[model samples]
Target: MTRRPSLAGRLSRALAACVALALIVMVVASTLVMRSWMLANMDSELHRLSQRAGERLDVEDAPDDEVDTDDDSNEESDDDSDDDSDDDGARTTLQSSGRAPRPGGPLVPGGPKGHGFGGAGIAEGTLQYVSEDGEAAGAVVSNFSVTYLNAPALAILAAVPADGGMHTVRLKGMGTFRVTARVVEGKTVLVGIPMDSIDDVVLMLVGVEIGLSLVVAIAAGFAGRAWVRRELRPLGVVRAAAADIASRDLADESGNLTRVGEETTAGPVEVADVAGALNSMIDAVEDGMERRARSEAKVRQFVADASHELRTPLASVQGYAQLARRDIGEASRTQALERISSEGARMASLVEEMLTLARLDGNRALTCDRVDVIPVILDALSDAHVVAPDHAWELGEAVDAPVLGDESALRQILTNLLANARVHTPAGTRVVVSVLRSRDEAVAASAAPRGPAKGGGSATGAQASSMITIRVADDGPGIPADIRDRVFDRFVRGDSSRTRDGRGSSGLGMSIVESLARAMGGSVRLVDSEKGTVIDVTLPAA
Candidate 1:
């Protein structure tokens, strides 16, 4: 089973952090903006109140009775006007900044309201204003403390520059406040408004934002889980199909596990494409396997036919040899003994070739090792001389030819080629075995049919090449153009009707050569030649 990453685990963790961070930013920003708006409103209101009070002051409409016109004429209306101005300022202070008189209490305790601009205020925590000279301007002692002004809300107040617009002040140990101080007539006019309403709104906004973030995170996690499952469904189907196909051996004629099911297309594109492609590949493999099975059945029938034909001649030869041995006549005994030996050898050769073909048809592993081609050819020629005494065997100069192959199989290849030449060539015919390094000739030998001439009889002096080739040629009746390709097949011969008279030649030599060459990761084929049959054996050099 294939293990996949958990979608919920990844999505949930990622979304939680993202949503929480976003909500925090939103809360902080909204709170700051709301607090600023509230302070601006309060500052505007205080400015309007000051302007109204300034507009109400009248210079010309001074009380005539209250201003004493003195006998000293130089003390003009200006002197009386200044005295009237001082009185109006004191009364305005008592009305605006003075605390409401307590019942049965003395009013304006500081010597009966002698003031130009004096105000009373409630001080709490860090909410205190300093004048341009840096001295405390308003009330000195109250609920707030100036030392502890580092809280987040209090930091917002400290952030406001002394020269900037109206801003709110939040004390660490006291409630938030909106404070504005401006210079009026060379004195600071300070006004403060509390920010409780704005604070409540900000708190509400924060709660709503956090709740929405949580909802979004939860919804996203659920959606991701649903999407992942839907996307992986087709892959699951494909996985099951592959597992079933691998476990089944469909070579049995019964069509049991051949069918693969189609899946729905409501998933990811990659999964759908994989399933479609896998099904097509499997179908093609199954068809090819079925065709191979039919071909193997045909090969078995052919083998049975060939075995019957070979066994009959052997049985007859053996019976005659037994009778001749029992009679004890010299001539009869000699002929029977010769027939028996020839028949037995022929049968053995046929059996050996047949077994080689059978090995090729089965799952046989070839043992490949480094073998020197030049020496192997020399050894094969020495063996061939005994078998073909009448034919003039010429051994050419040996070249350094190395190959990776089974040594026994390489020798068999040489034996088959020499035996083929001996069987086809006439007595006293010249047979040449040349060893040289030729790149094109080696390639052409493995690609084309065997010829009776060495590399098309064009003795292009040996060229330096990567591969080594050994050509065995004979000046005999060359194979016809049409049957040359089939010469390497089992039971096929140059002249099929002219059966050998028990000389151990069953037309299986070339077949053994073909099979052996293939097992060594090489091949044997006819080289184009004009004169006689020439078989070139090419092997890779070490």
Candidate 2:
């Protein structure tokens, strides 16, 4: 795959392109304006020269001056005499300053005489004129000398329409000129000015503009790149943080958290906003990973504890089976068989509890129905009395609190709570089972934030005063204080001993109770009691 260019590079290119385009437009407009101004100045000068030439032409009215034009030498002599003895004594004379006019290219200057009249703009340039008829013309070099090249030059000038509008034309030997025609009396006189000066100035202006534009554009490109990179520095820090997270060994469950610091989150508002979101995302990921690590640890402990639990019953069943095989006597064999059967039943119960907890953790949806928890509480109390008659079991405040839950799960929850009380307490412990409405407040008819479906979380409307609370309390030695906080954790019991009351009580009983309660959108908690264990199970009212 082709790698894309960086943002800095693209932005720099765009900035340079914009700068260059603007400069080009400005340069083009200025160049055109300059050329137009130069042309206008040339036109004005050409018109002034042509008008002066026409005024001079009307001085030569003698029939001899017109006839002598056929001879170049005689024409020059007549022109000198006419210029020296002008009829008005104020003759409008024309002259060349430096270069002599080309051979057959004389009698062209139309300005009045002298170095004082010709400045830097017109000095050393040729001035040409055409007669009224198409056949005659004259030129004068800047030295006040007259010459003739009237054959082709006169024909080129004769084409001028005397419209006073300037037009450009090139002569055979002379350079390009801006020429115009002015009619005086009945004759047409043409004036021509060279185009070299204007062209040189315009060319230089265009050349300088192109060079300057390139220099400025290149500078802008470099500066823009640096600026863009500077502004994006915070983003680079964020990327490094992400990369550090991505490269970590998350599968190993090490739970080393990662995050970008305040420096990375500090920048322009736009970048800062994105960085803030990035930090939040990092926090979420770290939390999830930490939870996963804790879950894995719990899974390992569960497996080990399960192995220990099943091993005892298996060993007992094996030992009893071996004893029955020996046949010490018929009565002894019969006792071994009964013992094996009891152990097998206990193993089956443990396995079933594990399966139920697993299903609840998997978030399997159960049949929800309105369950009258009062009967369930009484049933649990009766069963507890029959099993542990030495303990006084009674129902306390059995209210008409019907709850929305799976009935079987609710029975199992109550059964587990009562069983815990019976198994852990001494022979004379007083146990009370209660089903009462929540006293906090009425539940709002709206959804609320919840946790995993299995356990350890409350559902929406959990705080409603109308909720059902099933609390099983026993007046006996309370739970060990150090383990009270985690009493509901799997395999936790009042005592660490594997067997209780000569029976293996699967520690999963409380865990299952919590899981089932939460799966039904309820929650269970171990309440702090002064001298005994008290557990409260709260469920949403139907």
Candidate 3:
């Protein structure tokens, strides 16, 4: 299996990647802007310097007749002997003595005009000028003087256009400069500043940006990871809860209902939601386990009850058969034989009820048709009257409650209910059977509980006026509160408190009624009544 990164790690990586990308973009944009701004300032400076130099050249080199017309200002009439500028704001007019300056000579720019260049922090390679005569001159700030350029440097500057627009060019001996050229008094006047300062500043700025961007990206990664993990701390609580459940011993008889703490719900909404979902799942699992435990307990009780019940009949038949073999005279032998046959018949009846319950529990299919419950009630009442003539069997408040169910199953339900009343109550107890047409809510006890579908499943509130209720009630002592809830459970019989009247019951009677009713899309429930037991069976109306 491919190993996947943790949520925290993956999220941190994404955050870091985004930070790095943003920083890179900023660095590139800033570098370009800074470089562009510096070059613009350099171009402006070069333009101003070139114009100043051209003005001076026009005055010193132009012919006497041409000087006045070419001059932008007549200020060039100052004494030629004082060829330098000073702090008094005077600008210089260079002569160069019409020849190249000697190496290490007195500073030619030392006069008021040239001294103007000395202050103001003007440095070596800060200014250079190439004239029309194929000669080059440059200021060496360090030496506080001006010197002629070698032939190669002069040749490079001479090639510059005199259009007065700024340009960058590398000099043959004096490094690179941004320069402009123009004709001044029949001589090409070139003036420029070197490019070294701008290059150094821009380089340092780029270096700083790259280093800062990397630091920010790395810092973002670590900080983001911790924040995300704290926000999702609830997830760890949920995981621990799950692990605790998993570590349990969930055997057949074990019942553990451990749960996660409320702290697990404290976090971001998404984390809280996940923790809440886990709690819900745990609740469902606990409910299922509880049901399973009950079912298992019921099964054990059922097996023991069945064995005890069958053992009684088998022992009786065996004992009587042995007695008959003794030949204790004809009447006694006949009585033993009869007793054996009677016990056999009772056992057969019990087995039949058991088998019927098994098939009903299996959800056996039934053929359904409209059944008028009044007729079935009357027929079952007549039979109960015959079985226990001492009991007062009567029909009460009858209605034409037609239901869609198996006729035989409907008859069986009423028979079982009447039998329970007859056998459990006193001989003179009044048993009344009633029928009514009712709404689903009024008779919804007949509808099956919702779960995995049994065909079309149970009735709903939308099925208004769709239920037929048949109630079998008696005026005998009511069932004890303790066993009333479980009266319909298989093999669960009540004590004498319900006036069971010393009668024996298989206890499967009510369970059978319940199963058959539910199988036919109906339900059975015991109602709280003023007196005696009131068992109501509801079915879907035809």
Candidate 4:
């Protein structure tokens, strides 16, 4: 099968075709106009020649002179008679110039007095005289010595009406002529000129037109192709770039997907727009691939961390079960049972936290309701006091702090932050939870270091809207500087060794807190503090 032509090729061909078509139309129209003009000029010349012949015949028919009898009477006087004779001679010479010679008579090469019948210095042409009854009277032929007045030629000439207008006729011995017949002095005079020169001019003109038209068509095709190519150069560059992109693996992290350069993008608005759009599409695809890679990496780490956390609890439970099955005292059996129960609880909690993270990652919608953050913070403090009494837990200056969120998720956020403080720090660490309503602008302008919220949420319009900020700060060895920025990343733990008081912490507490906060159209960030880590949660107010 023949491959279809490219867009550029098609466009070039179309341009060339249009140019050729227009040139052909102009050439044809101009040729026809020129032909008509030449024919009109030839007809006009024939009519003028015929009219001149009629005028000469009319002059010849007039009386030669008044027959100057005064010349004879004055002959004795030399000066007077000489003057009379000169006058008579001048009149006689003028009459003789108009008269036609008799048929079969000795013909003057030029007419009498050196003037031809048509005009002085004119080319010799066909002339014939006919009687009023349509009989040939006489004829003159010069220049071309073709026999005139054969039977067919006489019939054609006799049939011509004695009108002043010219007509076309074909003579048997000759070719074609434009002739005119008119009555002068009671006789028919026929004047004619050959049409060979007019036919030759028209034929020559046609040949030149054909040759020139071909040259112009060829030139137009080549020139049109070049012009179209130059105009579509930018599109060609875009096409090449697209083909190059197609050949490479876009998902390959190491591959550089180059964009259309400025040189190629510059030109007409339409072409530049296409180039710009192509670049934008490439950038978007590259960005999407990077995000996908990061997502995959996070998934892998999450699976590994979850498995490791489960392994510890499973090992402890297994050991306890084996001890319970051994031949031992009732007291020893009871202790092993208690240890197994504790390990089982720990594993269950770890699994629950993992499930919650998965749900949040899936963007599960939560209960959207107005909840007062102060009450949630107080409840979390009470829980923290119960979980770790050795830690000094307190509630800072509180406010209404009404916000839009799921009550359970909001409570979990507070619980996670407070628990993180309790687990990471030693006993007697004062963990304070503060709830307050603040403007977004004030928080943004503050010099305190901030962390980014992790969910797919935007807070661009929140500057003008109200927000409630909750702070869970503690006097503990703050998160290590090395992992501070990545505190909210999944599987990242403050204690890189993943141990706190000989117990394994799941390390997903802070990550869940940030994800939940972002899901509720809010943000969570770690505030810089000299004494301990300060985690701030900002939520849109109800």
Local distance difference test, per candidate? 0.58, 0.71, 0.71, 0.69
Model 3: colliding residue pairs: 84-111, 84-112, 84-113, 84-114, 85-112, 85-113, 85-114, 162-181, 446-522, 446-523
Q: Judge candidate 1 against the unseen true structure and give its global Cα lDDT, from 0 to 1.
A: 0.58
Q: Give model 3's TM-score versus the native structure.
A: 0.76
Better of 1 and 4 by lDDT: 4
Report how far residue 156 has shifted in candidate 1, in Å.
Answer: 22
For residues 370-452, write the lDDT of model 2, one tens digit per residue: 99888877787788788788999988878886999899999899888888888888899999888877664443233322212
Q: Which one is best on lDDT?
A: 2
Segments in model 4 whose C-alpha atoms lie over 4 Å from true places: 6-12, 43-47, 57-196, 223-254, 258-263, 266-282, 389-401, 440-461, 496-504
Model 1 lDDT-worst window of ten:
59-68
Per-prediction backbone clash count: 16, 20, 10, 0
**Order by lDDT, highest first:** 2, 3, 4, 1
TM-score of each: 0.55, 0.75, 0.76, 0.74
Error of 1 at 153 (Å): 21
Error of 4 at 352 (Å): 1.6
Off by over 4 Å in 1: 1-194, 210-249, 252-310, 321-338, 350-386, 389-392, 395-411, 426-430, 439-464, 480-483, 489-492, 495-499, 515-522
lDDT of 4: 0.69
